[model samples]
Target: MSESFQLRVNDVEYPLSVDQGRNLLGVIRTEIGLTGTKEGCDDCECGACMVLIDGQPVNSCSYLAVQAQGREITTVEGLAEGDELDRLQRNLLEVGGVQCGFCTPGMLMSATALLAEHDDPSDDEIRIGLSGNLCRCTGYARIIEAVRRTADGA
Candidate 1:
């Protein structure tokens, strides 16, 4: 049964009707029209569908939409403030962390949560934080550097 629910996404409150087991990924991308979050391994093996649920990274592909009611969610679209890009984004570009870009958004979101918890994450922390996200394009060195740069530069 679909019921009324309010989901605060990217700082905007959206009224929606979602049933249990309705994937948050579809709601965010199709219903809400925020496609920055990619769908990879639907089984949660790939971190491409990552989003921040109340400031913590979660794989939206398997997360139920109804579970997000009354909670804050942040997609890749929320990383920027108008024209100013988040430091992680800037560093990603500057450090060549993005290549094919399929995994960029997830990487950025995961790194955002990591940096939020640890402003200066060590190399191992960056690796562990990004372990869920897989990037076949740029490898991981650049991505790790980008996160490190963003955290250190902050």
Candidate 2:
């Protein structure tokens, strides 16, 4: 059954009528028309579907859309300003952390949450922060470097 629901995404409000069991990824991509969040493994084994809920990283593929009603939602698309990229996005590109880009969104989201929680995360902390996101192209050294660089304000 479809019910009235509202989601605050990227600081904007979207009112939707969706099934209660619908996943937030679908709702974010389809219903709200934001597609930066990818659906890699529908089973939640992959972090490609990660998003931020109340500043915490979440596997949106397995999270019910209805459960996000009152919380703040942030997607990869929300990471940038009008025509500028987020510092992390710029760092990833500069450090060559993004290749095929499938896992970049989730990585950015997870790293964002991590950085929010830790101003100066260690190498181990960065690895643990990005443990959920998987990148097939880069071996993660550059990604870790990018996060480290961002943390260091370099």
Candidate 3:
């Protein structure tokens, strides 16, 4: 039997009837049509499916959809304001943090969560905060730079 639940994504509340055991990444992408949350490794190691659940980062690919009930979920698609990108998003572009773009969304989400907690995160804090997210491209230097720039208001 399928269970119905309400999920708030990007500030929009959506009613989803999902399988009892469906993972969050599939439900977000297939049911809600939010493809920005990528699924990589599906084992919570790659962080490709990172999303903010109540302002905390989680691997959506491994997170059960039902577990998100009553929680605010933020995806990459939620980080923008109409046509304008979020500060982190703009910084990523300026710093060349995006390569294949698969991990970019996760990295952005993680960075957003980190910045929310620490507006002026040190380099070590930034590195440790983003350690879970793995980017095959860009070698993480540009990604780190982007987060640092955003935190520094650059």
Candidate 4:
């Protein structure tokens, strides 16, 4: 059965009635119209649907909309402030981290979480932070460098 639900996403609260177990990925993309969060390997194994819940990276594909409750959620759309992109986003483009573009959002979310915790993340640390996100394109080298450069204050 469907019921009324509410979730705070990107600093905004959305209230709607949806299927009990609808994934956050679908809610964010379909209900809220923020399509940057991609859906790949919907089983939560690919990390393409990664998003931030209270500053932690999570797979939205597996996270139910109802589970979000009153927690803060951050999606790729929240990474920017008006016209300015976040440092991680600028670095991603400058370092050529985005290729196919499908994995960029999830990768950025993961990197954002890592940078939030460690300002000077090592190469291995960056890898570990982004380990959950899989990208078939760009080989991850540029992506790693992008995160590294941002973390190094470059």
How do the residues 1-154 of candidate 2 rate in per-residue lDDT, one tens digit apiece?
9989799999999999999989999999999999999999988887999999999999999999999999999999999998899899999999999999999999999999999999999899999999988888999999999999999996
Q: Candidate 3, which ten residues in sequence have the lowest lDDT sum?
A: 94-103
Candidate with the greatest TM-score versus the true structure = 2
lDDT of each: 0.92, 0.94, 0.93, 0.93
Candidate 4, poorest ten consecutive residues by summed lDDT:
1-10
lDDT of 2: 0.94
lDDT of 1 by residue, 1-154 (tens): 8877888999899888777668999999988889999998888988999999999999999899988888899999999999999898998998888899999999999999999999888999999999999998987999999998888884
Q: Name the weakest run of 10 consecutive residues (lDDT summed) in model 2.
A: 37-46
**What C-alpha lDDT does candidate 4 achieve relative to the native structure?**
0.93
In model 3, the clashing pairs are: none
Please say which candidate is ahead in TM-score: 2 or 3. Answer: 2
lDDT for position 149 in model 4? 92
Q: Which scores better on TM-score, 1 or 2?
A: 2
1-154 per-residue lDDT for model 4 (tens digits): 8869788999998987889789999999999899999999999898999999999999999988988888999999999999999899999999888988999999999999999999998999999999999999999999999998998887
